[model samples]
Target: MFDKAFQRVNTFEDFRTELVEGKENRAGEELIQESRKKQKVDDDKETTELKQCLEIIPDEEEVTIDAIPLAVKSPRIVDWKIHKEGTKSYYQIIRADRKSQMYMIFSHMLKSFEREHLEDLYKLVKARYGSTRPVESMDYLLWNDMKIMFELHVEDEVWKLQQGYKVLEWKLYDSCGVHSLMMQSMQIYMLVEKKYPLTPPTLSMMLERSFKLIMKVKWLISCVN
Candidate 1:
C-alpha cells in the first residue's frame, strides 16, 4: 500500500512539504533529507544560545580567603580548549604574556625533568631542589586531590601556583544576583627554551576557590525541581 511513497518523490521541496505537512512523506529518501535539515536547525539554535550566555561582562568582586591580598596580576591565558572524554574533563592550556622572560623561566622548570616518563616528573623536581637536607618523594598527582592546579616560578623572579587544575577566579558579573561567579581558567604556558638550563626555584600557592564538580552536580539537580 505504501509502495507509491518513494516512486512519486521527484522534487525535494514537494517531498519535504508532504513529509512535514502530511503523513504522505517518502519512506526512504525524503526521510533522510528531513532528518538532516532538522539536525542543522537544532545545531544553529544551540550555537546562538551559547554565544548569548558567554557574552556576560566580567566583574571583579572583593573576596578574601587567606591573608593574601586581592592584588594579583591577571596572568593571561590563551587558546583555552576543553575536552570531555568521560566523567572527568581534560584541558589543554596555553599561557601567553607580554614578556618572553616568563616563558623562558617556565622552560627551566621543565628541564628539571630527567625522565621522559610522567610518573617520574614529581621525583625529578624533588631531586633537583633538595629542601632542608631531607628530600622526600613528591606526590604530583595527589596535588590534584588537594585542589592544586598547576605550579609556576621563575627561579629568582616569579613564583606562583593555583589550586584548580585550571585558573579559578571570581569575576564580577552585574547580572548575577550577588556580583560574580568564580570562573576556572584552563591555560597553557609556552616559553623559548635553551634546552639545558639550571634548576629553577619552583613555588606552590593554594587557591581560595573550593569548587567540587561533584557538589555542583547535586546543587544543579536541586535547582531542576
Candidate 2:
C-alpha cells in the first residue's frame, strides 16, 4: 500500500524519472499493502466504535418519567359517635376531608386522651382548651359504666350529616354547680385507651415514653401495696 501511495505521490523524483514507477516496483510492496490494510482496519474500527457510542445514548422518552399520584398514607380511623350528653356544646370539631384515610388524627388523639381519662380526659382537654391550665396530671378512667359504653362505641356515625356541625357541651352536676373540677371527680371517668399524634405526633411520641415510665412506677407501687 505504501508502494502504491509512493507511486501515487507526484514527488520531485517522479519528474526526474522518465517513466512512471509502477505501484509494485519496490521490494516493500508487500509491507505497504499490509500497512494500507491496517489503516483501513483502524478506520473501520473507529466507525464501529462511533456507532456503538450513539447506540448506548438514551432517547428523550427514556430520559423522562410519568408523574405519580399522591396517595393517603396515614393510618387513622374515624370513630364518629353522637353526642349523648345534653348541654349546649361549647366547641365542636367538624372534619370531613373525603380523601383522608379517616378523619383528621387530631380529634382521635384528643379522643384517645378522652378514652384514657374518659370524662376526665374529655374535661381535661376541654379545660385545657377552654382555660390556660398547664397539664400536670391525668386521672385516667374512674367509672364502672365506661366498660359498657366502650363496647358500643362508634364516633363515626354519631351525628347525622347536618348542614352545619354541632358543638360539645359542658355538663352540670347534681349539686346545681357546673362540673368544674372534672379530674376531682375521679370516680366517674377513667382513662383506658389512647391514640397517637394529635397535633404533633413526634411530640406525642416523646410524651408516650415519659408516660410509660410513670405507668411503670404506678404498677410497681400497686404491686407492692
Candidate 3:
C-alpha cells in the first residue's frame, strides 16, 4: 500500500510540472507574437516615409518649368564646316536656332549693349586675326581676363535661368556649346592681339622673318641635293 501511495504522488507531481511548463510556453509564444507585430508596424511606417520622401523629390532627367516637368531635348547641329587657308584651319558652325524655353525666358536678361559688345568682340577677333599664331604663345594676362569675363557672364546667365520656376538642364546647356563658343572667342582674341599688336614692328613681323629664314634654308638644302 505504501508503494502504491508513493506512485500516485509521483504521478500528481508530473502533472503539476507539465501544467507549469505549458503556461510558460504559452507566455513565451505570446511575447514573440507581440514582438513580431511591433516589428511589422515599424517596417510599414518606414516604407510609408520612404514613399513620401520620394514623392517630394523631382526626377533626375527632367526640368520643371512653370510648375510642369518637361523632358530635355537633344540639341540640333544644323551646319558645320572646316575651312583650311594656307597653314591654318578653323571651324564654322551654324547650329539650329531652336532655343530652349529656359533660354527664351532669360534671353532679355543680357542687356542689348552687352550683346553688341560680345558681337563686336567676335567680329574684331575674326577679322583681325583670321590666320594667326597659336594661342599658347599669346599674352597670358589677356587670356586670363577673357576667361574670367566669359565665366562671369556664363554664371550670370545661369543664375538668370534659375530664377523663378525655371530649372536649368545641364545636358541642354552643355549641348548648346555656349561655353565652347566663349572659349573659342577668347582664344581668337588672344591670338589676334599677339599677332597684330597696336605697337609698331609687332611680334608677328618677327615670326614672319623667322618663317622666311626657314624657307630659305629649305631652298638651299633642295639646291644642294
> Could you say which candidate leads in lDDT?
3
Model 1: weakest 10-residue lDDT segment is 197-206
Which regions of candidate 3 fall more than 4 Å away from where they truly are? 1-3, 10-20, 54-92, 95-225
Q: Count the backbone clashes (under 3 Å) in each candidate.
A: 10, 21, 0
Kindly list the per-residue Cα lDDT of model 1 for residues 1-225, writing each as its tens digit. Answer: 365766556433665776676664455568899899999999999999999887644568555457655434333343323345575444333334532222122223233222222223333434544342322222222222111112333341211332223434433222211111222433232222212111232111112343455477789999997
lDDT for predicted candidate 2 compared with the true structure: 0.36
Task: Summarize candidate 3's per-residue lDDT along 37-75 as a digit string, tens digits.
Answer: 999999999999999888664567676557533333233
| Over 4 Å off, model 2 | 1-25, 56-225
lDDT of 2 by residue, 147-201 (tens): 3223323232211221122222222232211121111222112122433112243
Question: Which residue pairs clash within candidate 3?
Answer: none
lDDT of 3 at 17: 87
How far does residue 182 in candidate 1 sit from its true spot (Å)? 43
* Per-residue lDDT of 68 in model 1: 50
Candidate number achieving the greatest TM-score relative to the actual structure: 3
Q: Higher-lDDT candidate among 1 and 3?
A: 3
TM-score of 1: 0.16
